[model samples]
Target: MGSITVSGVGKAYKFYSSRWARLAEWLSPFHKRRHTLKWVLQDINVSIGQGESVGVLGVNGAGKSTLLKMITGTTQPTTGSISINGRMAALLELGMGFHPDFTGRQNVFMAGQLLGYQAGEIAELMPEIEAFAEIGDYIDQPVRVYSSGMQVRLAFSVATMKKPDILIVDEALSVGDAYFQAKCFQRINNFRQNGTTLLLVSHSPGDVVKHCDRAILLKGGRVAMDSSSREVTNRYLDELFGKPDEAPADAEASIPTDSAAAHGLSQHDDVFHSRPGYHPSEHRWGHGGASIIDFLVSTPDASYPSRIESNTQTEFYFTVRFDSDFDQVVPGFLLKTLEGIFLYGTNSYLSSRGTAHHSAQAGSVQTYRFSMPMALNEGHYLVSFGISSGDPRQDLVPLDRRYDSVLIHVGRDVQFWGIADLRATYQQLNA
Candidate 1:
C-alpha cells in the first residue's frame, strides 16, 4: 500500500544582496532577475516501492532535509514533483510542526489533525501517545520548556502514533537519549515489520547498514551514489577520508625545517602553540607546580593536523614538566564540542580503575599518550588536557590545566547523529 516516487525534483533559493535589490526586482515591469538562484538540490530521481526500506546519506548543507521536506509535503519543490501512493507519516526536524507555547498534548491533537486524523480519532490515541512520550507532568506543560530530548520524544510519539503506508525518519531521532532512541527505533522496526515502507536518514553508516537494505548518498546537491547500503556507505566513507578540501586552516602556512632553531629552542619552545590545531583562546590555569609545555596529536597518515578524518586511529601526546614534587598526580583529557558539551573524557586514574597510584617527582618529565578511533561526526571539537593529585575519596589539587586548548575539525560521513561513530555491518546469513 505504501510507495514513494520522486521525479526530477530540484530546489533552488533566490538570494538578494540587499533589500534595495529585492525591491527593485519586484518593482520592475520586465521582472528582470536581480537575484541568483542557489540550487540546494538538482535533478533528483528515485522510486521506492511498497515494503521497501531505504537510507538517505548526505553531508551537511547537502539538502538531505530539504528532500525529506518536499517528500512529506512540508514545502513545495521549485521544480519537478513527489508522489506518495498511500498515507505517509514523517519525523523530520526536531520539534517541527510543534508550537513552543503549546502543551505537548495540545500539539498532539493539532499535529494529528494535520496528519489526517479526525478529532475523535486523535483523542483515542492520546493515552498511547502520552504513555510513549513519558514526559510526566511536562506533557501538560508548554513545549518551550522541554529539553531537546523531551521534544523529540513527544514528536516521535505523535509521528508514529498510528501505522501508515509509508514512514520517513531523519537524524532528529538522535536527539533523544540513548535509551529513548532505542524505544523509538523499536517502534519504527515494528512499523516496518507491518509492511510499512521506510525511508531513514542516519549519520552513522552502521545504522543505515543495519536498518536499510538500499541507500542513496547525496553530494553537492546531487545523488552521488545509490546502491546496497554496504556499498554506498563504503563509498561515502572513502569520499570523506580522501577529501583534499578538508584540509586544516594552516595548510597555506608552513614552518621551515630549521625554524624551531631560528625562533627559540631546546631551552623550551612553545611547540603546542605553533600547531595548526592550536586554539588561540585556550583557557589555562592551575598551580605552577607542574606545567604542560608541549603537545602533539597525530594519525598514521598525518601529524599535528587541523583536520582529522572520522574513524581514523588518533593518538594524543602531551609533555608535562614537574618543577616541584607533585604527589599522587593523575593526568586526564577531554574532548568537547564548541558549546562545552562533554562528549568524551577520561583520566589516568579512571583508566587504571583505581588500582594504580601515581606521583611526580621534582625535575621529572612525563608524556601521556592516548589512542583511539576518532569516530566523531563532522564538526569542530575542542581538546583539553589537565593533571591533578589527591586521594580518590574527595577533592584533588590541580597542578596544570588547559581548557579548550586545541581546536580540531572532523570530516566524516553522517551516520550516527553526534560525537561517537559506530561501526556496524550487516550480512544475511539465511534467506
Candidate 2:
C-alpha cells in the first residue's frame, strides 16, 4: 500500500531571543523563561491513495515547506501522527541529501542505499542515472562544485530512476532549465500513469492545474480549501483578489477622448497580417468600477499577424469601459511563459509612453494602445491584462484584470539563450 495518511499534523519550534536563552532552556526543561513556542503549521490533515496526484498550494510562509518535510520524514511533527507506507522518495530541497564531499556518481549510490536498494541494484542503475543527469565528467567530480541546476538534475534523476511507490517533489523543478523542467514534468506524468502516488508542491497555480487531480490551498497554517483543481484555483484567486462584483455606476456620463490617436495610434496600426478569425480566451477578475471590453494585438500596419517575429515591434490595443467616474486609470499587460514564469510586464503608471492619468465619467469606453518590441525568444507566451487605479507602482487596485487574455506564438527555431533575446553584439579585439 502506497497510501499516505496524515492525522492532526502540527509543527512548532521553540523560538528564543538570544543564544544564552536556548542554553538556559536546554539546561532546565521547566525553565521556559524567554523562549516562545511558534507554530509553523497547525492541524493539517489529508489522505492520499495509491496512484493519486495531489498538489499543495500556498503563498510564502504558509507552511508548505514545513508540511512537505513532515511528510518526507525529514522532520517530525510536534503534535499528531503521520502514516506513510511503501518506499518513498522526495526532492525537497536543492542539494538536500547529497554530501558535499562525495561525487555525483557516488551520491547516486548513497541515495539509492538510503532508499533501500542493494549495492548491486544501484550499480545496475548507475548508468541510467548518469545518462539522465547529463552531467558527463562532472558525475565523478565533487558535488560541491556542481551548480544549483546541475545538482537538481542529478537529484531528480536519482530519485526518479528507481520508481518509488511514493514520489514527492517540492519545487525542485524551479531550479532547472526550461527544457529540463519540461522533462521532469513528463517523468512525473509517467509516474502518475504507472500507479505511483505523487505529491507535488508549487507556488504556481498553473502547475497545480496542469499536474494534480486534486488540490489543497493552505493559508495561515491551515487548510483553506480542498477540492478539484479548478475549484481550488478559483477559490485561491478569490482569496487573493477578493470577490468580483458588478459595475457600480452607468457608463454614459464619461468623457470620450481618443487616447490611442493622441499617442499616434490609429486604425492603420492594426497589423493583423497572418492571423485569421481571432477569438479571445481570457480569465478576468477585479472590482466592479470598470471593465475591459476587448483587446487587440497587431502590428503598426493594422494587420493581425498569427505569430510575432523576433526583434520586431508589436502593438496592443486594450478597450476599457467605465461605469463610474475615476480620477486615475492604469492599463497594462504582462508576458509569461507557458509554464507561468513571468517574462516581462508594463503598465501606464510604469511606462513612459502612455498618458499620465485618465479622468472619466460613467459610460466611458476608451482604447489604450501600447507599442512594445518582441525581444523574446521563440516560444508560446500568455498575456495578462490589467486595468487599475491609484499608483500602480505602489498600492494599486485592479479595476479589471484578465489572465491569459492573449496567447502569443513566436515562430522560427531561434536558439537564443535565456528568456529574452538580448540581441547582444560581439566584436573580437586583438590581444
Candidate 3:
C-alpha cells in the first residue's frame, strides 16, 4: 500500500536585488515583499502505485532533482504538496550530508542516524557497509580527500544498507566506474523483484527503458511527457539530440564505385592521408617498398560522411602500389574503439572469394575494397589499414600499417552501452 503522490507541486527560489533591500524589508514594521520568486518546477502532478519503477529524465536545469528533493523532504515545495507512503531512502547529490572534515566511518554513523538507525544498529551493520563500500583504509580518512567515485561508493552503500520500501537514485551513481555501476544496478534489480518502489534519474534512454516501467520527461521546468519508458525516451532523444526526420537507409544504397566519381578525387591521386576522417596522429610502420595511395570511404548516399546513423553498411576502397616485386601480398582493415581496443578485423586472404594473394611485379598497382556493417553503439571509433606478406600472428612482414588512421562518428546507432550494437527487443507475455 506504499506509493508516492505529487499534486500540483511546484518550487521556487527567492531573488533579492541587494542585501540592504532584504535588511530593510526585514527591519520594516510592515514588511513589503522585496524579493522575486524564480520558479524551478511548475504544476507537476504524478501518482505511483506500489512497486512501480519510474524514471525521471531531462537535460540539465530541467528541475528533475528539485522534484525529488521535495518528495524526499530535503526541500519544501513552494506550492501544492508531496507525500511519501513508505520508508524511503535516497542517494541524492553525492556527499550531500557528509561532513568534509569527518572520516567516512564517522559520516556513515551520522547518515545512518538520519535514516532512523540507532548507534548500536549501525554498529551491527558496519561490517556490511564497509564490505560493500570497499574503500579500504580511506574509510578512516576525512571525506574531503575522497574522489568523486569514492564518495558515491560510501553514500550509496549507506543509503542501500537496508533496502527501504522505496528507493530513489539520482545521476550521482553515473560518476562511478563501470564495475560499481553494474553492482548498483544489480542490487536495484533485486530490490525491484521484491516489490520496492523505485525512481531512477538518468540521461540515458537505454537505462530508462531497461530499468523502468514508466518515465517522466521534463523540459523548461515543466512536465513535457509522462508515458511508457520507450515512448518518453524516444521523445526525449529527439528533444535532446534533434535527430533528422529521414532515417538512415536500412539496406545499403547504390553509390558510385569509383573514387573520382564519388569523392571528387583524381583516379591517380595520392591523397589517402587527406581524407575527412584521416588521423594525423596515426602510428605508421612498415617495409619501404610498398605504399597505400588513394582511398575513399562511402555510405549509401554520401562520401566520407562526418557521421553515420544507425548500423549502416559502409565500404572502404584503397589503392596500393608495389615498388619492388613481391612473392605475395595481403591487404587488410580493422575497426577499433577510440581507446584502441580492436573490434573486428579481416584480411583479403581470409575472404570467401578464394583470391588469397595477388602477385605484382615492380611498378604495379591494385585497388582493394572491404565492406562491413558498422554494428556499433553510438560513439567515436577508429579504423586502421594494413598490408602484409604473411600470417597475422607469426612471421608476418607488415609492408604498410596505418594504425588508427580514420575516425568514424556513429550517431544513435543503438540506445545502449558497450562497443557492439546487439539489436535487442522485448515482448510482454500472456501469463
Candidate 4:
C-alpha cells in the first residue's frame, strides 16, 4: 500500500553569525568546528495510511513547511527517519524548482523529469497538462512573464498529471482566483476518490475540515494535537483566541423579550426554531466586555422562528449588553453555507445611511435590527453575529462574537438553482 511513516523526525539549520561565518562553517570540515544550529521541528511522529487524507494546520513559523519538506525529500531531517512506499508529487511554494528563463513547456518537461518520468512519458502527458493549465499560447513563453495565477495553474497541472500514489498540496492553491480554486478542489476530490494518499497544508480551517478526514496541529516546532479534522480545527481556533471554555449553554437562546413579545415564539418552536443538533458551542469566538444577549432570525411578516420561503423578506435582530463604555460600536452579521463558505455579510460601518460611531455607558443595552430580502436557494445556513468597538473597516476589535449561532432552513420553488436566486429572465432573439 502507498503509505507514509514519519518517526521521531526533527529539522535544524545552522545559525551562522555572518556571511563570513557561513563560509567558515562550510570550510570548517578541515578545521574541526561547526556552526550553532537551531531546530525548527522536533519529535514529530505520525503514520498516514494508504488513501488517507490528512491536513497539516498551523500558524506561520509552526514548522509545517519544514515537515513537508522532509517528507518530500527537499530537505533531510536533522534526526530520525522518514519512510515512503510510493511515488509522490508535491506542490509546495509558488514557482519552486522552476527556472525563470524556461518556458512553461520547458518547465513542465523539466519538472516531469525531476519527478522520474521519461521523455516519452512526459510527451504522452503533455496534452492533458496543457488542457488543464488553460494558459493558452503563454505556455510557450518564459515562466518569468507569467502571473502568480498562471504559475499555479501550470504547477498544479504538472503535479497532478500522473496521479501519483501520494499527493502533497501546500498553500499554493491560496494564490489562485476563486474559479481556479474550485477546479483544483474538484481535481483533489477526484484523486481522493481514486485512492491517492493526500496531504494538504493550509491555514484555512474551513478547507481543512471540508476536505480532510483527520488533521494535525503544529505549534512551536512540535505536534500540538492530532485528531479528527473538526476537533483539531477547534483546538487551533482556541489557541488563536486564547479562550478555554466553549460557548455558554444558552448561547443560542434569544434575548429575553419584554412582556410584549415574550410569548411570540412559543407556538412555532417545532417549525421555525433551530433544528436539533445545532448549538452555538460548535463555532463561536470573541473577546469579553460586551455580550450578545439575544440573536434571532425572523420573517418580515412577524413570524417568530424565521421560517420563510426563498426570495422572501426577512429580519435579523441582535440585542447586545455592554459591560463597559466604548468609543464606537459596530454590529455585523454573516450568512454562510453549511460547508462554511461565506456567502453574504454586512456591518453597520458600511451601511448606506453612513457609519455609526456611538458611545454607551456601562450596563446599557442596544438592539440593532436589519431588514433584507433572502435570495438564497434551498439550503441550511448558519448565522454569525458580532459586536465590535472601533472602525470595522479599519482595526476593528470584537467585543463579543458568535459564529453559527442560529440555523435557518430555506425552502424554494422548483425553478431556482445554486446558492442565490437571481430572479433572472431570458428572451429568444432571432434574425
The Cα error of candidate 4 at residue 335, in Å, is 11
**lDDT value, candidate 2, whole model:** 0.76
Which residue ranges in model 3 land beyond 4 Å of their true spot? 243-372, 378-431
- Residue range 1-431, candidate 4, lDDT tens digits: 66999999989888766778867766776864556779999999999999999999988899999899999998999998999999899999997878989999999999989989999998999999999989999999999999999999999999988888999999999999878988998998998899999999997666787789999999999999999987887677555433234433333344434421342322212221243223445455677777776644556453333235778777777667788988788888888998999998888867645646667668877777666788987556888878888866679888888788776656554434379888889999998
> Who is ahead in TM-score, 1 or 3?
3
Residue 130 accuracy (lDDT) in model 4:
96
- TM-scores for all predictions: 0.62, 0.62, 0.64, 0.63
Estimate the lDDT of model 3.
0.82
Model 1 lDDT per residue over 231-340, tens place: 88756654543434354443322332222222222224445675546777899999778888777666766655545678878877777778888668888889999899
**Each prediction's whole-model lDDT (CA):** 0.81, 0.76, 0.82, 0.78
- Per-residue lDDT, model 4, residue 349, is 68
lDDT leaderboard ranking: 3, 1, 4, 2
